[model samples]
Target: MNEHITEIVIFTALFLLVSGMGFVAARWRRADNLASLNEWGLGGRNFGSWITWFLVGGDLYTAYTFVAVPALLFGAGATGFFAVPYTVITYPLVMLVLIRLWSVSHVHGLVTPADFVRVRFGSPTLALLVAITGIVATMPYIALQLIGIEAVLKTMGVTGDLPLIIAFAILAAYTYQSGLRAPALIAFVKDILIYIVILVAVIYIPARLGGFGSIFDAADAKFAKTPAPGDGTLLNANNQLQYITLALGSAMALFLYPHSVTGVLASRSRDVIKRNMSALPAYSLLLGLIALLGYMAIAAGITPIGTDVNTVVPQLFDQMFPDWFTGVAFAAIGIGALVPAAIMSIAAANLFTRNIYKEYLRRDATDAQEARVSKLTSLVVKVGAVLCILLIDPQFSIDLQLIGGVIILQTLPSVALGLFTRWFHRVGLIAGWTAGMTAGMVLLYNIANPANNHAHFGGSAFPLSKLGFDTPMTVYAGFLALIVNLAVAALATVLARRLGSSEGVDGTSPRDYTADAGDPEVKDDLEVAGST
Candidate 1:
């Protein structure tokens, strides 16, 4: 085979192997019934610490992580390193949020956050809004994974989106058949291959480019000569606060994501969630190594050959390693995209079937029907994601995901706060969601960069200049939107309580928050009720 053909052959073989593992996953769990939503969607909720660790890690640290993080460092310099602290902080933040979510979900057997939001706040309308918001935010994200595979394809000189379409179709099929277990099983292999690829790239690429010092020095010298000042290896006073706030803000929003919550909620126990968070920080170490690939690209004089930052890692692999080894790295990223993409589709589909379809459209739907609808919906979700990759600009796909972060953040007050107390009226939560969402959209649409004449776009810091600021201060949209959300929630909460509105009974007891896996009360389903 020609070199390009050889790369394609190797990638295809590796992907097929992963898909085969996916088909075997349902059998791996020896699921009691494949036709049940619980068995299919959540893997019977029996994932222990080790399996849950890999599943959650794989679900959270995606193809986007492998490609985008390094690409950020490569393209923007120090600002790209924001991913470092964001990932470092994500575990502890999730540790706090997930323990409560696990307890409540396990207690009520709730499958999606929308399910929790609906029951906890006593509002079907709000739950539907949350469900729709989640699906919208997650769709672009699922497509972004295709960008990762497309990156590998482009590096190998493989052209056309047709191949990516075929690959994703295969992914959707197995995921539909095997459900969460499919992705969870394949995650084991994806993580292993990615770890190997990152380890080798970190060690060998630096040596080839002289060393880490040489790489950084070269990057610094290059940027110094170029007109892109302060665009090198360090964050400066101008952007330091923005970086810190964006990093922490993203960490807070990370687990609040519907798919992320779905991933954590599938675990068997509270301790399982905690242990995974503790051990999951090691992914940050891998991420640190991965981020340096950007510096290596700069040292190797690599600039993005395309607009997609997702291609940087693959291009770096093509330049730094042999053809066969490059194929391996390509496979890692391609399969990496597959694992999370599958899980995201499944999560989004579950939200639709449980929170939307069953709640509003078909209250009498059977377990078998729920399973069928979820499978069909999973297929549709993957199809829409592919259309996004085909019809929209890849750069816009990334921006849309950031907007998803903004949208998902709006639910934090309703979902996260509701887990603590129902003192906040449902009406107040809805009002807060509306206010925060409107403010976020307006601010996001108004954000612009002088570098590009594009309107209503750009992922950089939003200047507060129009709001009367001259100090070069900028803030992330997601963080700013969250502040508005909390403020509206607090204000509306006071008014609702003052007006003597009933907050409704929370079926969840105080003891539910600390219940363990084996606790009989955990599965008793004290308040198994929802929208008609």
Candidate 2:
């Protein structure tokens, strides 16, 4: 424990500094009033290119990217690196869909994707479905951030649940006080520390352990001895299908997460969205480097200290880096967790307040009331996430995120495709969402991990044979579930139209999908609330 003092001190200092920034973030770019959802939930939606870049970067490439990605690589091998290509393709996909979402959302004064769904299809029930999906999907993700922080704490000789409680309490307090601005402000510090630590580790660690070839050779040797399927330095015939589908499915699912959409919507304009999409792939490159650290860990002969493989990277830092640098690296991982966790809680809070609380609980809620409820909801969400980490296994949190992608991908037809075309009837989309979510959950439940004593809710790999296929092919449950969703949505659309089901009035015009920041319909404040 005495040996951990350096890390504890450095990590605590940085944590306090960021905590202070989180509080001060309330005034970072002060608006006239913080009483509205627009101001409290989205930082007034006026952030420029640089702030958006860091904010979105910090939101997307989370502790999952840092801790879980490398840990997956450490434990399984090549499958973990799927995050690389997934992130690579994510920007292009976002470019295609998100700009239109931003425009439509801006003109409609939408604070959540559910708001866009409500306006686009004019179905409050369907919007409620979208909102619930966002909230449920985000909860596990926020829990994963805590897992990341816990990995750091464990490495620093910290034990027990008390530290996690305190850390999340602080996180919840600042997030309630500052709202979206808290994460937006702290994202700068989080990214800087991450960039520095990752750059140093990528360059220094590889050079220290012979070279890239040696690292690959070491990982290959380690995995070759393991009897587990898909545990190898390279993909094989059996797992290759799972690899492709997982990457593709993850790319499609990434931006569908409400927090990702929140980051996109917070941009000042469509141009900012496009420019950031173009620029965000730089983090993908960084992610690729970070993934390689798994191989570096293998080459350095580092083993995880306990049953949790997520500690591989933190232990790797403690083993490889100097004491002070290990502390810095630990701080990077810890603070990295905070930025995304804050954003996700805020995003989920906005969904509940706007779509659920406002629509059902209190239709007459004023802006101040909405903001107040959202702040409290954000606190509850954070506490829920903390409880998730403490109650469930961390590995389960990671797998739940995989399930989250599956659940959220079901929203693609309503949120992403609905941005461009309104061909699918709202009822059909609702039917699709239900079918997809149910099928995905059923499939996830059936895929068990006997080794982990999990009779159900094991992992994301679902067998294709379950779909009446003869061959031994496996695929990502999310992708297969999404196909089911789209097919059902299409078939239902045809039947609904033939049966003369009402398609609901579109509350938006085509020009609304092309509006910019200064457009008359774009509501920046109460004065322009009449325009919406």
Candidate 3:
């Protein structure tokens, strides 16, 4: 602790500086009043391309990403590169869909994806399912961010849960006061620091490790010595399937997450979303660099502090850089956590306030009432996230996000697909959600990581051998569950139609999907609906 004084001082100074910025963010955008879901949850829904870029970039490329992706690469070798491909696959695939989401959300004043589900499907029950799934899925995600901070702190010899608690306390305070604006404002600083650290690490650390060629040679030699399956510079047949499915599954689930939807909905218009989708892939380039840090760690021989592989990168920084720059790197990781955690909490809270609280608890809830409830609920969501870190104690931190992807992927048929087609009935959608969620849990339960010495919920890779296949192929549990979800949904829909079941009326029209703010059609559509 005494020896780490310089790192601690630099880390603490930057952390406090961001916290101060968080408190000051309520004034940055200068909203008239944040006592509504539109204002508080969506940052007044008027962010231009640049603000949206930083906010959405900060929201998606999170601290857990900073810590965990590298950790995965360090431990598992080339399979960890899945994160880079998945991120690359996501933006182009989800771009058009997101533009529609942005337009519909803008036209309807929707706050959460579940809110869109309710409008699109006209079923409170389905929306309730979506809301609860989002909140539950997002909780562990928020916990992962806290774990990211914990990883850095532990490397710096700062122990106990006290610092984490205090840090989130500060996060909760400003997020409470300023809502989405707090994260939106702080994201500029967060991304800048992350870029600086990543650029420096990729450049300076590789130089110190002799060069890129030496780093790769060292990593190759190290993996060759151990020579376990899936533990080298190249992929094997067994792990290749897992890598592909994980990448594709994760890509589909990325934009469907509540926080991701929150960021999209915060945009002022469809063109902003379209422009952002084309531009956001730049972060994927950053992610590719971030993953290389793992090999750099292997080359530098930077062992993690304990059994936690997440600490390897931080330890690498401490070993390679001066204490002062290492402190800057730690600050990057810490502040990175705050931005996304705040967004996730706010998103989960908005889901509760709009879909659950308003739909179930208070039908006549005002915009102000909804805003107040969401603010309070965000605090509760953060508390739940804290409890997840303390209690659930996942062996591998990446599981937090994968578990979430599996859970939220259940909503794909209703939330993501329902945006384009209403062919699936609400009942079928409900059945699909139930079946997918159940299968996801059961699959997750059967996964056993012998290395981590955990019996259940070990990871997302479901071995085909478990299904009595002779091969060593494995698939992402979430992707498999999504298949089950879609199959059941389609079969049930056909059955429901044959039985003369009533498909609930969609409150939204096709025009709604194309209506953007300030458009001529948007004004008239809002007038007809009396929502905006």
lDDT tens digits by residue: candidate 2, 220-312: 999989878768988877777988899998998888899999998888988898899889999999898988888888888887877777788
Return the candidate ranking by lDDT, descending: 2, 3, 1
- Cα RMSDs, all models: 2.3, 1.5, 1.9
lDDT per residue for candidate 3 within 429-498, as digits (tens), equals 9998889988998899899888777698888889999989998988999988998999999999899989
> Using alpha carbons, what is the TM-score of model 2?
0.97
Candidate 2 has an lDDT of: 0.89
Residue 473, candidate 3: how far off, in angstroms?
A: 0.9
Candidate 2 — which pairs collide? none
Arrange candidates, best TM-score first. 2, 3, 1
> Cα lDDT of all candidates, in order?
0.83, 0.89, 0.87
Pull out the clashing pairs in model 1. none
lDDT by residue for model 1 over 151-204, one digit each (tens)?
Answer: 888888888988999999889989988999998899999999989999999999
Q: What are the models' TM-scores? A: 0.96, 0.97, 0.97
